[model samples]
Target: MMKIRDVGHAIWDRPLGRIVLLLVGGLVIAVTVMLYPPLRDVVQWFLPLGLIIWGGSRVYLYGRNDLLSLISGCLLILGGITRAVFQLIPLNELAGTVANLIPVVAIFSEMFAHHYREQE
Candidate 1:
């Protein structure tokens, strides 16, 4: 019979095993959050805040040297701020959708610009 410690070590040794474990942990947390109304509300409220932090960090780290990255990161930060503001203001769903799309479109445009510039 294998020892529990050995089994745990075996799981940690494989990349797939680690990924599966991380995914399972995330699923468990997601389900737990969904089960509680208050927790769900808290998560929703903070989600945009998380996005803002992520975007700001990206801008600070990568935007200094690359103008396109700066634009894309700024758009991401704007989208997060717009979402947070709309949550409190009771805006139309279309406004929120547009806000969410800004970062995605900016990123894609930046990528294409970089690709074309490199090809020249």
Candidate 2:
């Protein structure tokens, strides 16, 4: 039996295919938001929600890995939480996004530092 992941893999396994898929999906979402009007408010979550899920998994994995990585993952999770909360807390959207990005950028920097430590 072909699983959903296998079907997705078959369809989106190529670089061009992936880009086309993203463009098409985004277009569809854009059209839907244009049609519904109110959906634009709800649709703002696609990214931060994705980050929250990813960060949660990372936090769980890193909890067993090491202290620094666990801390970084916790920070990533916190960033996602703040981004979601900002939606309700009444801040400028661009400013909130930029502020949330700081933790993500710092986490990447820490990851790079970890990579260098491993290399040395």
Candidate 3:
């Protein structure tokens, strides 16, 4: 029988274990979204909005001191606005794709910027 401390040490010691846990969690969420149409729709509409609101709040709180946060937050807010506007308008699929990519690219850019800055 494994002790609680042993289990905690295993989790902390193994990065692969953390990755596996995250993957399993993601799979469960994916399955749930696919099985439930209402949930799928709600996630589709609200997840980006939630990201936008969260990002905007972060910007308001920390943007003054951090340039990367400001840029990322603006990108998130812009992505959300574009997504919402696209939903309202009957536009082409490409526009929708761009709107979706905006936040993802912003996140990646922010991560890269931070990593580069840390190396300096």
Clashes of each: 0, 0, 0
Best by lDDT: 3
lDDT of 1 by residue, 78-99 (tens): 7678877877777677987776
Q: Quick one: how many clashes does candidate 3 have?
A: 0
TM-score of structure candidate 2? 0.62
The segments of candidate 1 whose C-alpha lies over 4 angstroms from its true place after superposition are: 1-26, 106-120
Model 2 pairs whose backbones collide: none
In angstroms, the error of model 1 at 89 is 2.1
Question: For each candidate, what TM-score against the reference?
Answer: 0.60, 0.62, 0.68
The per-model lDDT (C-alpha) reads 0.74, 0.74, 0.78
Candidate 2 lDDT over 44-98, as tens digits, reads 8765676667667666765576666566666666776777787768888687877
In TM-score terms, which candidate is top?
A: 3
Off by over 4 Å in 2: 1-7, 66-72, 89-100, 103-120
Q: Model 3, 7-101: lDDT tens per residue?
A: 97898689998888789888998899988867877777785687689678758876897787788778778877877777678778898788778
